[model samples]
Target: MKLTAASIATLPPRKLPYPDSLLPGLALYVGAKRRTWLLRYRSGGGKQVHDKIGYFIPNAPEGSESLGLAAAREKAREILGRVEAGVPVAEAPIHHPKTGGETVEQSLDKYEKYRTRQGGRIKSLPKTMKALRSALADYATLPVANFTRRDLRRAAEVIADRGSVHAASAFLRYAGPWLKWLVERELIETNFARDVSKPAAVKKRKRVLSDEEIRLVWTAAGSMEGVRRDAAKNYGRAVQLLMLTGQRLDEVISLKYGDILDGKWRLKGEHNKSGRDHVVTFSKTALKIIGTGEADQRVFPGVHGKISGFSRLKKDLDKLSATSGWRLHDLRRTLFTRLVEDLDFPEEIAHAVCNHKQQGLSAVYNQASRERQKAKAWEAWDDRLRVILATEKVVTLAKPLTGLN
Candidate 1:
């Protein structure tokens, strides 16, 4: 019978192979665990070979490891062509001795554990693993030994075609190091992903919202409405806090009332990107926005954890504020720039306010929080921001807007 996707879905598990009438030598075997596609053909040596093509999915999408009926047929034809030409073909279900017969997905699991033990960035591991999984989805079930440079290139191309060259490049960055680790452990003979050309480098964003743009965004965030009004308000408050404190978005959104004490917000090492405890003194305006909350409760409570749906929230915010080409991170950048450029605050104080990591000998010895200096900077910023928000006309400065300090 013709092997249709619907027919394949209902096929019962049996010891016998169900042959496909449409594709010569192509068959499906429905085992208790999985349905797999196979090609049965006679080799040049007159030996009958049962070549396993791949597993079968009723309707597998593009880039899936599992093959649909159409994809299976195509693979079967390719194998048969090689068989006819007397060319050697690698058998499916490859078991490499060095890798202990582990698949790509299995190796990735081991890699994650190894990296964690080696002191990999705790906060970034999940995101890196997630990107690698997505980029290598088509090869997840294949043995690590079977992965080739061609396969890495194909995976990157797939991601690039989907519209994010930056994501494609990032995939290579993550995968290359992991593949190299496999090589060092003798799991694979070579790092196949090492030489894959990445997409062009993305330009670093230098966008900083002007005072007028800041005011517009601040006003629009406060006046948000509709079904997601509460969530929107929470996100808006987080944005405003980012602008006020020059703190990272994740740090702001993940804030808990317990972290704040005596008008100073403290961030634990694990909760921040720097992996060092950070403390920032809050201005009166920032404190009012945070208000009073239970010690354990989140300042901006999300449905699950920290507030999400940022892309949608940002789109709505852009529409409402009449702002474009600016990111939430730009708020943090704007704060730092305004502090140093307009307010004449020293660069070191601005760095303290942003909790930027120091370098060289200073990084090892300097443990000072610089609380007094940071508080003074925040006070000056608060005054400047209030003036910007209150004015109806856009304030254009001919030179540095100094003297607030």
Candidate 2:
């Protein structure tokens, strides 16, 4: 029998059955606000399922005795008309996975697999997935089908409550792609977290160090204990290169012996965000840092257990920065700012040293392999660094290493 006003009133909150001829497939009653209702409907065999269609607001003429009841009837009639014509309807509203909910996790796993298989240069993939795992570890055992937006908001609150804006941002960012994917795949009804805003980027308020500050930091870092000492060595070399060559730390640290072909360091897509190869010519300081290592050797090798992480490295620097007063990355920025601000190095050559893939057609066509000019540029930089280091006597951090580690 067709679901009518009196019939719906007598029915329970959920699983209120309706006639297939009048409606279509199974209709399961969900929630309501007096007369308005949210329902679940499924089409075909078990292939297609939808959660919510539209609200059942009481469409009363003038006044009605039972507003909610009258509205339910009208809404039912409209939904039934659409179903009978075989139009697809919402099965459920897409929501954030609840505490102990795996809904978003499932979506994310599939997305990751697709991306990996597609062979994209996802250098940050591991970091992104690690954040997702950490955020949803507690909800791992929960069913994927029961995720809701309320749950997601609560999770974000919990993370923010713990005073971790960075962590919260990480979780939210990782969840975003998966949420969009679910919406596209019709996994949930709609993406509730789609409108969720992300945290603002940490400002790069830091600038390159002045000559006086550079001496102080170099002196302090070189005088420290253990890995920071070696990190200081790498730091020394990297700083000199940065000053001379003007490359970012990420691009410089990833440099290997093999990449140095005919006096050029070639950074592959695997090491960079830009899917193009970059060529950086080493300065005399950069070459000295290279120091006769095997072709595949890393320019800077951390000790047995020092994590290859910026945060970890930052903490180490913070402790030393008290005496040195120079933030670690400022070394790179110092090089950039000095070249651009003080020395007036061409912006193209400055960016080229960092292996920054420029934007638009210019980035593609204006690729100048200025290895000769770069070499000359870096030679000038080496002389500058030597003058600073010798004058300041800044290489005695910790016990003096007879040879580079």
Q: How far is candidate 2 from the true structure (C-alpha RMSD, Å)?
A: 12.3
Q: What is candidate 1's lDDT per residue for 179-240, written digit by digit as tens?
A: 99999988778887767888666778899888789888887776554344367778778788
The TM-score between candidate 1 and the true structure equals 0.71
**Regions more than 4 Å wrong, model 2:** 1-102, 143-154, 189-194, 199-204, 221-251, 304-327, 360-377, 387-405
Best by TM-score: 1
Query: What is the lDDT, from 0 to 100, of the residue 79 in candidate 2?
Result: 66
Model 2, poorest ten-residue lDDT window? 57-66
Backbone collision count in every prediction? Answer: 0, 15
TM-scores of the models, in the order given: 0.71, 0.61
Please give, for residues 352-376, the per-residue lDDT of candidate 2 as tens digits: 5555667989767875666555555
Residue pairs with colliding backbones in model 1 are none
